[model samples]
Target chain A: MNQTDAFHRRIDEALHNAQLRQNFRSALTGIMARRAEQFPDETQLQALRDQARAVRANALVRQPELLERLEAKLTENGIQVHWAEGPDEANAIIHGILERAGAKTVVKGKSMVSEETGLNHYLEHHGIEVIESDLGEYIIQLAEEPPSHIVAPAIHKNRREVAELFQRFHPEIPYTEDIDQLTQSARVVLRDRFANADAGISGVNFAVAETGTLCLVENEGNGRLSTTAPRVHVAITGIEKVVERLSDVPPLLEILTKSATGQPITTYFNMISRPRQPGELDGPEAVHLVLLDNGRSRIRVDDELLDTLRCIRCGACINHCPVYVQLGGHAYGTVYPGPIGIALEPQRIGIHKVGTLTSACTLCGACGEVCPVRIPLPKLINRLRAEAVDGLRAGTAVRGHGSMRKPAEAGVWLLWRWLYTAPSRYRLFTRLATRLRWMTPPWLGAWTRYRCAPRPAQRTLHELAREEGFRNE
Target chain B: MSDSRERILARLRANRPIEVPTPTVYAKPLGWDREHCIASFMQRMQAVRGEVHRIARDAWVDWLAGELPARGIHHLLAGNGDVGDRLASALPASIRLSRYDHPIEQWKPALFNDIDAAITHARAGLAESGSIVLWPDANEPRLMSLAPPIHIALLDSHKLHENFAAMIAAEHWANGMPTNALLISGPSKTADIEQTLAYGIHGPKQLITLLLD
Candidate 1:
């Protein structure tokens, strides 16, 4: 199936799934309420958001220099830093590292960058086993599915589903739906993997330049285990995740956890400076960091769209988005989903491929309001819509796919514009519509499929205004 | 890779947004008194399901000796240093105390599975977040606090700071950073299964902080 058709099918499936909708509704409602309680002082939250925006803006302005400095400092601290222009290079670099280590098994923390690169598939194809250590990620991995949410990968699945999945995969362990027992099962399985894994991979939350530290924020201790247990550790992140000073991390981290999970801090905030230093008993013998650009440079160049890069991947916007709550993350059919995904996916993948993803938004601005970094998400979505329309009209490859716009819809819009521009024509059409209101069709395509169509009033508002002696002034 | 690096950097430089000076916005201190700060720390820690124990400076040894057996903590893993020596000397002969004196590579599976609890010292504490800062070095390996099911952290009251920003600024982390430093707020927990919170997924399920005054 074509991308547009597939998207619509996914949306249809999601809309019909009452259980999925209820799950997301409750989850998002709880998340939103907790976030509100976490930031009781609105003024302080806004001030901190403004400060975060400025920090991100400044970081982008000095991105190249900051990244270079980060590389030098990390190298000085005995870390091997590799730069990848895109996903292919990133996967190749990581695979090369694993090959040199002769790694058969690799443990991974929740790294969205790796997801974007399809690293698990890539490594598996090369005969290297990759295990996700995070409980959420591990559950999804066992089910052979993509994460439905950024933070909570298996949010769409209920405990019963997970119990069944664990039963299917872990036959040795008795089936139990108890959260603690389930968690213990995963821990027992993953602990063995961590002990035996030759290489570990994780995503960096923030890379501090001055201190040469790669910081990871996670509630689960899997992140620490992924980075520490194996002989070789590889950390991958977007080029945009670097900051100038270690001091910059605290404020970002403060807003990150509060906005993401409504916590003052995550359970574990690991600041890794280097591989096990001299005489250090534990930690990876070698630490490698891969900075993946993956079309972020294109985003960096666009003046209007550059603010989208300020996203911290906290999933706050996703939790607050009205369209997202209804449809869930899988409907978007992208690694990153929701308000941020609508704006970002087009840039990362060709706009033509996922251009229809922009239509998923109601443009409700809730995303922008809750965004800790204050990215104007609605404006970016509108921009993509406009670009898609223009691309359709011009048949241009430079813009994202215009395949979503049907010729019939375009013609109707053009006709509506023509009538609206001329008062006489518009009045004449309204009069005709009123006269022939009975002949109006019940089906107005998709719009009237689920709801009643409005009929023309007996008298036009203009005619009523004239009879009432009301002047235009 | 160098070519990719240069190309990526060049593109970034070419597309760099208009430069703005970095903002100087440190978080305001809570300014709570010592007692209030400790209380707040305990409250925050408990909120995340972490256990906090306030002990008089001189009573820690006696407290651990009495508590270990009652808590079913038999095989305790600790750092091979003064702290470990003190713990070993104080604990009763019934409890098995193993000192982490060698590289974890030598006995990875045994260290992670055999120990019931691991005790380590916190470099500092953050009152606002109720987190303990751990800078694991040769003396204290990282796994001691992570591998065991129960993690016992010893923290001094004087080391508590109001927030993360205050602690980072005061400590001058910019000058130097440890190879592996962590700010642990609670034990390993996950709310992944239908949003039901469960502890000890891959790390310590019980995080017991012994706050020394």
Candidate 2:
């Protein structure tokens, strides 16, 4: 089996656990509900989202200049900035930094970029101790599983299971079913790591080109501890996070929270401008930013897929997605999940590797509607479907439409081309298909698993109108 | 490396000069009127599984008591110490009423596991989107607003902002503002598993906002 198949099998097996389902269900509902409660009116939130989209668009248009500005300003402000063309380069940069620091212990905040680069595993393989600071992240870390959800990493695990895991992993610590007790236990354990860690790693939510600053927002204070407590702090981020100006921040922040956790704002929005200036209370002595291109520069130039770069990793699209509900994030087989993941994974990685993620969306446009930056996700996915089909066909016309050509040759392509080319012909075929609906072919049931495929509205709308005595003019 | 650094530095200096855009030529009004905004906000709130009430200020305490038993909330962690003190006296002693004033380290875990509901005053209510802004202060631990099963926020009718821009401005202006501010609309929820609707996952199961008029 390929990487995609293996990832699917792992998550599929986990989904059977009733406890994980219950936990995921409750968590998703609360997050969706909270987000709605936070931004109750769609129109109001949409406006904020549009404004944010405009800002992101502006940043993308001037990314080369903005990135250069950010590097200089961040460097001047006492940050060592490194430019990485891809994941390997990013990992190498981080590895080099850690090696020079002689850092044996590292604590990590929740960063999707780190996941993208597979940093923790890389560091651990090299004999460096890495501990996830976020409670949800820590839970998944113990489970030896990748995060299923972005914001709430371990949304798949129940409290009882968490207690059991904690008991087994840390035998000295007592098992407590209480969520708060569990959080406290994790906190106590993680705090020790934070206090003693030689280096801290973080993912930036937004980087300001104007101020050459990095913004870290988190509900838990772990982000603060990760950035401040360690002797050295290194941020791994994609180039897409750069915004044009510091003044443009509030509008983006306004929508990010509402769209993310339905919070008007996150618990903490910490801005690190310069490394701890003299008389500063607490902050890292040295700050470094690894500006990772990682295929985003290519994505930025692709007009069809570029809007995806505007995403703040809010996971709003996932919350509203129907497909994500059934399979979960791990099923997407990539770091980014849900609707955004479907569009992003193919670009960040190779399309063939994440080809299944592209087919996961329902095309309901819920993701596009909910997106703060107005990314036309559904449209982009549709465009990708066409691209994928074209690539599969490879320009050679197949047999089928002309029976005289060759009956034994490839049929799926010829069928698709014929069906898609003529709307009237396809409508007639669908009308005939309605008649054959009662047949209930074995394979057809699997096709209709998620859909009823209602019997073509019985008679046409024209027929119903005619029966109602309206003349067809 | 030196040459690359110099090249980068020169580029940064060239772009360091800020280019301010022309003022928004057409700042369209948010596509909602006052009543419509409130109605839409409430609708979205209900959609996300939050219980919203439009109530009079004088009737607040009685209504709070009435909703709790009906909603099966027996314990509450309230941020307003004075209000919590009053609530303790008003309710039967059998029902636990804990005032939230502990340090973040202590309160975070307590709020997560112990409290049935967490109630705090909202700094601003966005009419356009049924959202409340709660800034973490000395008395209120940031986690208390999130970690619990049910979140109850009191929004003074006067605090309603027409839109989010106004909400941000008001937040910057709120005196003694803590470093962390949260704009919470509903409870913590996700549909990561089979799109099933489950309540009270990582955060609150129920989100209740009392729009005090």
Candidate 3:
């Protein structure tokens, strides 16, 4: 159960599976291509990105005021709000709401927040049968697997694999390899559950402080159904999702859809201002908004760490990450994966727990380039890597800042620094390494396991320059 | 709950960064007139697999009457509005009519299984994205636009906006919000199956725009 062991085991298994590698490769390649096509005008895309970054930054700067305004507006509009500092409290609040409504079964739309809190498992432990309405989510649920990709949770599985999984669970329904048939099969099953479920839960894409509205963006209508068809609806989100104004929504929404799925707009953009009004024919009679802190408020306090919250959960960074393309989501052994995970997990779980993840980055800068909100993910990952060794920030804030600082590793780095700082020692070391090159082993530790061993150059660059009759200016 | 809320807000207030002013919303305008909006809306809608039919204002019911039976639709759900009421009175008995007149609990099973299609009114249309904005209320309800297999939206040309930002500013949505406001661009779809496009995964299978002048 140790973080390092779990991550290493999952990573080893993932790298050895050729099929999983192909699945991530094909899916990410297609997503990257479509994302490029959507943003054909470079100048316009940059303008939109800047606008989005400013809106998010403004919201974060004024978060406390905006959240108070949001709670007041939502209360005025007839929505009950609750707060939780961690996952346990969040899950408990949701469970209490469902219990008050006397709900036994629940239908859920796609929610990464719910996953972060492990809501499904929590509810099921309390005797609630939860059905996932989103197709990708439903598929993964049937397989009893965590989501592999944020946007496409079931993207790691092929059509044949989905068909097999569906048949294993719902044998009464005929099986077919056709994607349409497979999709329709999920539709038929989840629709039945949606119709009968007593309560619904969903995630918030953007909660507008100006209008006290919770906006949900989705291509499938399941988000609408999950929030509408049931007697009670519970919407949970991180506190950072709130925006300052209604007009702020347009550009953010525009960038989110294009960056997330390369769509002009999704099939449904559902905004809920309140529960059903007096004598309304449909919609949840009671709506609850649970604002989860879960270390985000602490994350907000640090200026450098706060930029990680600017992520819209678009998954563009994930789609464009070369490391993620090779390893996939499951290999990270966390709720979130890819560049965002490497940067965020170490902070949320503490540097001591998952700090090793920071070293996985190639720092190719693709994730930063495609990030709609300009999160500077590579820079943040590099920051985490340093934080693991000896963070400049207070250890009480991030926890275990210098835990990865092993004496051996520290000694090696210190010796290297000592030698490199002086011209005489550097010259002697280079001379000894070049002369001893024939005795160098073909394999090093984990570094040379997947790579060739490094050997010193036959002559230092300074020696070559001297031989060529050139002098330092 | 109160304790947690207070502490969370306190932490946020204490650690909040330097204030940055909200930037002006930057949405590219189509810079086109009504005819251009219609053409652009149609082209974009069609590109996303939406069916756009330019019908005369009074001929929508007649067109619906002819089209429902041709598609073998036996039961249809409509709202309690002008067009919905008109369809109820005019359609033949062969095509059964269902209204979202009562709370969904009254006929949850029928609404989920029996209805063949649903028709709702559009408050506005975005020309750039080929999307219809629906303000669902007591009479129409949210599921009327989402639950069924087919979504037939009646859009008026006079209600067209250049884009989403234009619609928000013109309508003064910042002043007030609805129970549910929706922007539907096309039918339900997903590429989750190894990135293969499949329609009608959990929502409507088709999105038909009855554009009226």
Question: For candidate 2, lDDT tens digit of each residue in B36-88?
Answer: 76676677567656688989986778887777877777888876456676687
lDDT of 1: 0.89
Q: Is candidate 1 or candidate 2 better by TM-score?
A: 1
Model 1: clashing residue pairs? A352-A400, A352-A401
lDDT of 1 by residue, B53-86 (tens): 9999877889989999999888988897878889
Error of 1 at A344 (Å): 1.0
lDDT for model 2, please: 0.69
Stretches of candidate 2 off by over 4 Å are A2-17, A279-281, A392-445, A448-473, B1-213
Stretches of candidate 1 off by over 4 Å are A391-406, A422-439
Which CAPRI quality tier does the interface of model 3 achieve? high
- Winner by DockQ between candidate 3 and candidate 2: 3
Name the lDDT value of residue B162 in candidate 3.
94
Each candidate structure's TM-score, on Cα atoms with residue i matched to residue i, is 0.96, 0.67, 0.97
Candidate 3, residues A1-473: lDDT per residue as tens digits? 76677778888999999999988787777788888899999999999999999999999999999999999999999999999999999999999999999999999999999989999999999999899888899999999999988889998998888999989999999989998898888888888888999999999999999889999999888898999999999999999999989999999999999999998889889999999998789999999999998878888877888999888999999999888999999998888899998878888888778887887799999999999999999999987777787723554456568888778887898899999999899889888888788878888999897999887777777889989999877
Cand. 1 TM to true fold:
0.96
Tens-place lDDT per residue, model 2, A338-397, is 888878877666555665566677799998888888889999777665554443434221
After the best TM-score superposition of candidate 2, give how far the Cα of residue A373 lies from its true spot, in angstroms.
1.0
